[model samples]
Target chain A: MQMDERKRKILRAIVQDYIATAEPVGSRTIARKFDLGVSPATIRNEMADLEELGFIEQPYTSAGRIPSDAGYRYFVDCLMGAQTLSDEDKEIIERESTKKICEIQEVVSQTSRLLSELTSLTSLVLGPQKGKSAFGKMHFLPYQPGQVIMVIVKENGVVENHIVDVGDNLTAEDLQKVADVFNQKMKGYSLSQVKRSMLHEIYSELSRQRHLIDNALEMLDAILDGSEEDEPIYLGGTLNMLNQPEFRDLDKVKSLFKVFEENEPLKKLLLPRQEGLNVTIGGENTLKEFRDCSVISATYKVNGKTIGAVGVLGPTRMDYGKVIAIVDFMTKSLTEVLARGKPRGYK
Target chain B: MQMDERKRKILRAIVQDYIATAEPVGSRTIARKFDLGVSPATIRNEMADLEELGFIEQPYTSAGRIPSDAGYRYFVDCLMGAQTLSDEDKEIIERESTKKICEIQEVVSQTSRLLSELTSLTSLVLGPQKGKSAFGKMHFLPYQPGQVIMVIVKENGVVENHIVDVGDNLTAEDLQKVADVFNQKMKGYSLSQVKRSMLHEIYSELSRQRHLIDNALEMLDAILDGSEEDEPIYLGGTLNMLNQPEFRDLDKVKSLFKVFEENEPLKKLLLPRQEGLNVTIGGENTLKEFRDCSVISATYKVNGKTIGAVGVLGPTRMDYGKVIAIVDFMTKSLTEVLARGKPRGYK
Candidate 1:
């Protein structure tokens, strides 16, 4: 629990060596690899103290030591800094974030791919769920002689259509008159605002004007009553787990993928923090199955309001310093892109 | 290639054994597991002949014979039949196919998940691109003071919205008048039908009435001009690749994932035939990366028109009989769901 300067240096050495070569770091190897200016015996004594203190462990396969979950936590929480990405990486993140994307879904999907490709680790992005959007347009178009289709668009570019039955006698011009009223009232308002106004005004009016295309008004009311569903969660490089030595066992891979199948409960892992990146080392995650993994996540924003999260999932031996910087840079870049919403030529 | 009954039986026995155990089948083991009415020495002689004919192989690790790509092709082409799914599996497939889902994307995504979970292999579903949907409705809604959003809905429940600048002097009533014209003429028609009528009529009218709200007309023209982009390719159970005994090599996993990335080119592997299921074993695939793997695909339809394909990807040692049956049943089930489009109460 109480770490001196010499102990910290030796622990860092063990962690770095183990990460580089998926093998245990012995005292001689650490002493030789790191210019700590100490003999293998002295390093071995410090390693013994560190292992006794629960920072590292000696694997049964070799005399070398590897970082335990506690060791990784100390490294991530106490020693890690804001990693500086290379200029090439920065350029890649910036370029990918600013590239021409077709739909908002495409943006989320492309970002997931880029994050995984950059890190060679599994990446996940959640949110911009199209639930709270500014109300855009509403219209009633005739379907069959007795059926009319109501179409609504949210400012976030989500569109929904509902089929409702209207009287055969109700003409298109008559339906247009009712649509005009909805437009007059809903301009520049979000779906919530429209809901509030409709509850306040449309009910009594529909009751009184039952014959004057009121059925179409009721249909418009119903269409405006709801927003779109949750935006898709994009996951990339799921098979990257196989490349890790930790996942060579088939059972471990199954449990990890079982967590992926249950995406709903995993969303609880994303907390509502306002700023800064969050790191949860092995054994610190909410799900028990993720004890062998590490997650570095950050809440991303659009127009300065945090709306979603982007995170990386990898073995505890993940390149924390590098991956954190990449995720951090991407969070900012994605925020900027999402804040702009749609680009000029995007469909 | 012509095959006698004995050779066909021997190939089938090898394929079934290899698929089950993921190990080479020695003549002794095959004789013990199956009553082939032959002694171990006779079975061994047949296996040698089969290996010489390229139907089976001897891995460096074992003296047993494993099915080659040709063996699998022969089994599927001549010996295999539709494997009967168990009652539990039938219940699962039925339950998953009939479950309530909100978005059409969810349908594709859930189906992918179900297929993968059931087969313990990677699953892919290509498209219902929304290009050939029955036209639903069109609506234009005001956004800012100077812009309006045009929304279109397809009967298949795909929604698209595009924003265009409108004259500041244009009233909501004027936009409604334009919508009414669309409702009158475009009802009960697909996008192709609208294109035909618009080409015959709207061009002359727009030329004659340029000043009478031509901007709104132009926006409608543009909205109707484009068809939907390719629907996203849904893939699931990628991590399942790691569970395969054949995928123990990381390099093999990487090459398989590389094929997953180049999805556009993979579309060429799908055939143009309108009915039934297809199997491409090992080198039968278009991409060289998939030469060690096999694909079992089936063309699915919405309203009797084949619009897309669904397939499973696994090693050549995959269970062709079981996977083919599942793919076939899923294709028909997916067709039913897509034709129904949306269930009651789905947003």
Candidate 2:
């Protein structure tokens, strides 16, 4: 049998109704609520065909139907319609996102909160990659007689500082000269670019300052690639997920919570497939915790490179059209703010 | 009407059993589970007096009894005995807490995760007050032609850097001179001390560099008291709270979650009453969201000052002995780490 237009309309109505009421959608309810322009008997015949084709499922003996994972996938792929966000929502998202946020961590945390508030679902926001920050300025200050602190300021205004001990051979003036040499060579380059290409030149020029350079190079790598500054997922309004009726089962909530605590698994689930919005329906996700959830994510960017992602986790009965629209708008707004914050000292 | 040792033992047994099972305690179960050496008829009579004293209550018309807020308070105050953690639990907590974490925020986040994991309850770890960090070192680095970035390294390895614009008269030499003067006077003091006592002396000496000094002081104040670095309540294992049987009601769970999101309310709830463990039973909480829950918090200190707090939030039938022990142990471990991490620049 062909998957025709009429069957598509019926499936959309079922998914929409289940999302609204958290109840099974019956053929009669569809006939009454949605203007599919068909009788309940005809709708029932179409529902049977849809279920047979695996686009929908009858959960139990007497209950109405729910969209299966394949059903949601089909709808997302071929049938999802135009999504419009309200003027009020657009204003709120824009306002929260455009605040003068200097640090990427703050931006991620704020974005996560706004997404959760706007959509009433748990939101996860990871910061731009550590390598995304270009080297702006590095400062060398005498911490004590034996130790010096190196502070690296990124053009985007993130400051990461670490301590290193210097031998008696290096004076405070020598520290400044060493800093200037590194600064001149590595200026305007992000850590990723520097690590990939610039290390050979840096290592050769500072050969005479071998003792200090050894420690300095180590500090530089740490500043660039270290996990100390690795921005973990900023989870916001996480409890909002409990509002869903399907999570009433304690065991179900426990399994999902475990995945959240073990953030790496959920991070894998949200990692971008291509670029833009990626939706994984129930059973489409490999993690057992997410088997009951549908994840909708969008990778956010800075200067054309995809650096991080934002995601919303909810029951499969989520309002895909509305949530997708919110996510799409949020990522764009985030990108605009990031563009405005061009790294300082890049020249 | 005389309250004797037997009555205290019965109340303790009832509270302990209710906490363990999340079920109403009955006279027969008490006889079977705890060795009170009393008949069911005698236990029933004692239970009536306990209820009359507002320590235990019956829901609807059930014969089984659950402890009321008053009962919990009575147990915590008098009947509760000291509880010890197992050797395995002690080792796990010590290992996790004693990791070589230098940043206060990372320390707080790790501690929160450990507390939540050890107790199987939601944990809240507040960061130390901003004024708690003493000055370690300050570096002045040239940035764009008109601006210079000032990086302040705290003893705890936290680096805060901000860009400041310099005037035309302030040559590179003058910048170094101003830095040396400020560094000489402010080397051993905290930001609070610098702001409180040394501002006048420094302002008079660097009067020619007043334009930069004005902005630098303003920046210093902002760094010391800014909300950007405000120690937010680091909440961990929040989903674990859903595992409680009491959270089976979606509405209750939703209301409680609202408090978690609106962190100010929850912060108020956890703020220390004194310097040690604070046990606020269900009705004892001022916040309405916590009326059905209990909180156990202990203030963690650095040096001798009480800097921040750590707490656990759970339903009133919480395992008080275990949770209290965990909170107490976690706070002490945190204090030791803070002590070891004395700010770097302090003489």
Candidate 3:
């Protein structure tokens, strides 16, 4: 793992050339192309030493050498140059993110599409963590007989509707009264803030109007129970996988497709982390299907609190340095976008 | 391509064995495992003839023979027997599809997941074509000074929301009256059904109510213009490609991932077709990236009209018979579910 300047230059050259051509690099090719001012024989000697150090591999006798996974790891850690996003890329991100921030769902969904298109990698953006969000406003509306519509509007302007079956028909005026009372009582209070004691007090006060209060409580339970539907994980750009040669094998391709389809494993993979970007390399992944791949993920925050994760997946040989940088940049960009309120022209 | 019964049996044996073991099949092993009642010498003679027929190949002189692409193709076409889904798989599909039919997005998303899980192959479900749908109901709700929330409800009960910025301000009552009038006039009419003459007549009649009439016209224009946000092609289960051995090569993996992320090409790939299922094999797909993959896609229907496509993606070596059956069954299942007004409560 320890290397001097000459070895570092040779390894960097090998990785860069291999990444570009996707072919093994020869000492001659590196000497000719890089103009390192070294003879092929000397370069060969150093490459042999580097191979012994496990940074490179000779795929076949005459085909020259390619960077091994260890070499990629080293380059990503110390040798690979920082990749600055082009002005065009920055403009794209700004233009795309600057659009109306209607809801957290819209933000995450659009972010997923924009990042995937920008990075040309399969991108995943986890929905806002509901547990992290404080309750905002809850409204109840009557729809049809025995059906009540409960709407929860988050501070972030996400409005989710749930239909609860109350099993008893109620007059429209009575339902309107219930909506008013429920809104007055629950406004600006987090679900957790409504403690059992508080609920007991409210229950006793409304006991005289038992039927209306019971239906209101039932509606409250339905809204709280349906919170899971509010948090939807967004994935975009899966067809991009068809263009990669790594997925050419039928079995490996099928297994990966299955993994993406069966999102439970991936949901676990993108769970919110405490700090720093999480990089799970091939063998390090718990899922057997993803063992040959690497996931570069970072949790994006809203108001300095971690709310969701953004991730990109590719071969383990993915340009970790670049992907990490891209993911980091996207998360930052998304945070800034979400912080800024909806654009002036938008509703 | 023509062969005797003995030759067909030998080729089928080789393909089946290779599929299971992912290893070359030797004459002795095939003869022993298959109980062909022929000696190794006789089996070897048949193997030599099979090799000459381009049905199999020898990786090395001493190694066993592996089925060539043509051999696998033949097995898929004429030799492979029907494979049944397990009872668990059937129950899973039935349960999941039933639960998912409540929402259009969930139906497409879950169908992809179920197909990928059952076949262990990547699946793609194109979003239902909004253009093909007749308008069921449209509602316009005033949001702020100059913006309105246009909610379009389709015949299938799919709801799409778009925020349109109009240059005029209207009161809440005016917005509600506009919504009611528009709904009364446009119900059961497709976007194409409203002609310019019809708009002119309505405009003339509502000349006194300029703001409401103008906003309604703008809403109609926005809907007909097909804003990008109004319709998005759904792609699911792409992570499955990472598990394919063909993508083991880093560059190949990157390129494939790139294709999936850039879905414009995929949208073109799922172009509108007439009714029935369409299977595009390797070399048949126009996209260069998909030359090695096969797509089994079928258009779904509502009210006897094609609305969207659902498909599975896998290597050209995929089990065609099984995929075809699954796609066919799922398409029928989806149509039936959508046809039912609401899912029946499970006991």
Clashes of each: 1, 3, 34
Interface RMSD of 1: 3.2
For A150-178, candidate 3 gives per-residue lDDT tens digits of: 55554444444545555575566655565
> lDDT scores for all predictions?
0.73, 0.80, 0.69
Best by TM-score: 2
TM-score of each: 0.77, 0.84, 0.65
Q: Is candidate 2 or candidate 3 better by lDDT?
A: 2
Model 3 accuracy (lDDT, Cα):
0.69
Task: Give candidate 3 misplaced runs (Cα > 4 Å).
Answer: A1-152, A163-171, A192-347, B1-4, B24-27, B39-83, B94-101, B126-130, B138-152, B161-169, B201-255, B262-281, B284-288, B295-310, B319-347
Question: Which prediction has the highest DockQ against the true structure?
Answer: 2
Candidate 2, residues B1-347: lDDT per residue as tens digits? 76789899999999999999999999899988999999888999999999998899998576699999999999988888886877787898888866775456678788888888888898988777665555555668876777887877655455677777788667888888778777788765666676644788887888899989887767766765454354478898788877888888767767877778666877787897777899999978988878989999999886687878999989999999889988988889888877886533211
Per-model C-alpha RMSD: 5.9, 4.5, 7.7
For all candidates, state DockQ relative to the true structure. 0.34, 0.52, 0.16
The alpha-carbon lDDT assigned to residue B134 of candidate 1 equals: 55
